[model samples]
Target: MQYSPDSDPSYDLKIHAGFKVVRDYSFSFDKVEISFKDMVRFIFPSTGYLIFNLFFGDDFTLRFLNYDLSEDLPHHLYITGLLSRGMLITGQQGTGGGYAMKIHPVIGYHFLRIPMYQLTDRQVRLSHIFDREGRPLRQLEANASARTLNDPGVKGFFSKYLPDKSVYLRDPVYHAVNKIISKKGIIQVKKLATECCMSERTLHRQFLLKVGLSPQSYAKIWQLHFTMELLKNNPGAKLQGIAFKAGYYDVAHLARDFREKLFVPPSQFYRDVNPMMQSYLDFPDSLQ
Candidate 1:
């Protein structure tokens, strides 16, 4: 199906990665996008489009083929879980103004409960990629998708639970801190406290009450998350170069961190873990 941005009143005002991807039918079968981290996604409700999940986000989808989003008007969203991988296999569309956030699955789930914070990111297995259920979970393939906004199967899932104004009580703290992490990879706790205009103890408290993981842990996660991204883009980059770019002091430090998070060293093989190069080949302009 074709997708254009939603112009209605209820949709999330933010856009994400606005770009056009042209598919050459004779030269190629399909163009695919794959990402491991969280990313902002949008679809125009006026146009019927199925937003397919490419990686770690769509663990609980029920249906895989012939899904519809035209009826999903009020723009429902949720803080999605950490997807092992992510992919989008479908027709062309336009979207903009969003990026991948650093929040972990545990912390992200809490954000879903907030009303004003519609985790617009969704997980859906594409029919073309995986036949039946999209990906396997707990030994078997998972068979669920975020129910359509107006779908009878799960109507009002977001409305019935999330708050009306803002779902997060610590919105200011989380927003400011996360913004810093986005730009700086790793940040000191004391510096984070000052940046948010809150005390050190208060920052820790807010993190605990709202998000289960501590701030330091979250930063480390984002650090490695960024590392994975850097490795993906600069495939020829050596360990030290990748380390410095991703905010590490040396190659050993980078290797240790990679092992701690992904259970493998940087030299082992990241491409085998995920098809990073092929995904980039799909969007040459963006990579350039």
Candidate 2:
């Protein structure tokens, strides 16, 4: 059931662009300890699965907050949901070694039998809900911290944990979700439901089960994400043009989304943000 590393195109450089921003860790599949570098702050949006972080760094302080974007207090080792608003992660940048991977949202619940609601929009630790399973997950973290990152070990781990193509194809909602993503969240819920050959209520329920978010909310997330991406990529382009291209009614509409999701106006965010940091959080290298 294991997938060959060679079969998949390399996403390492893209996924860990922030680490690369700070310093270059040449790609190598010989061992698991991917690198020894200082960690930087990056905010990962709910675009995909939960990422596993096994850091062996000193003075590491990780925290997760709600959609409220409160930085007053933060908790270490946070568990995020499919509709997780956003996360602001900060850590010391120094001698660290680790292995990390993104676990598909559906696979996490399907194979692990984790309830999506428990993690939805809440900022808590893996131990909170994974009470009995926490010990093993923590042990896995320990194991990951100890070993050097190698191709075989990484491939073996994913093959054991990730759902196969059959599982994805078997789910009816998967196709619907794919349709929404293909349109970049520019489609309507009713149309999506019709395309999926289901009623709106059924589509809502199915999306919640498979994606941990209502279809409307899921679409909004991608809309905002795409808008942000447009702004980031088109510096010389006019804001109005970007807004229209992103399917927003107007520049004000786009700004509203920016405020809601990023906790800042587009102008302020663009001025203060670092391109490298955004590349890490928003998406992979090519897309960013």
lDDT of 2 by residue, 1-288 (tens): 011122233322222422211111122211122221333444444564444443344433233334534221111234445655543443323333333434445555564456565556644444445567455445545454323333343334434544455776677676776676677789988988888889999989877776778888887876777776787788788888988988989999888877666667776666655433454344331100
TM-score for candidate 1: 0.47
Question: After superposition, which runs of candidate 1 have C-alpha atoms over 4 Å from their true positions?
Answer: 1-150, 165-170, 275-288
In order of appearance, the predictions have TM-scores of: 0.47, 0.68
RMSD of 1: 15.3
TM-score of 2: 0.68
Candidate 1, 65-133: lDDT as tens digits = 122322111112222222121222222222211122123222233423332112222332222122332
* TM-score top scorer: 2
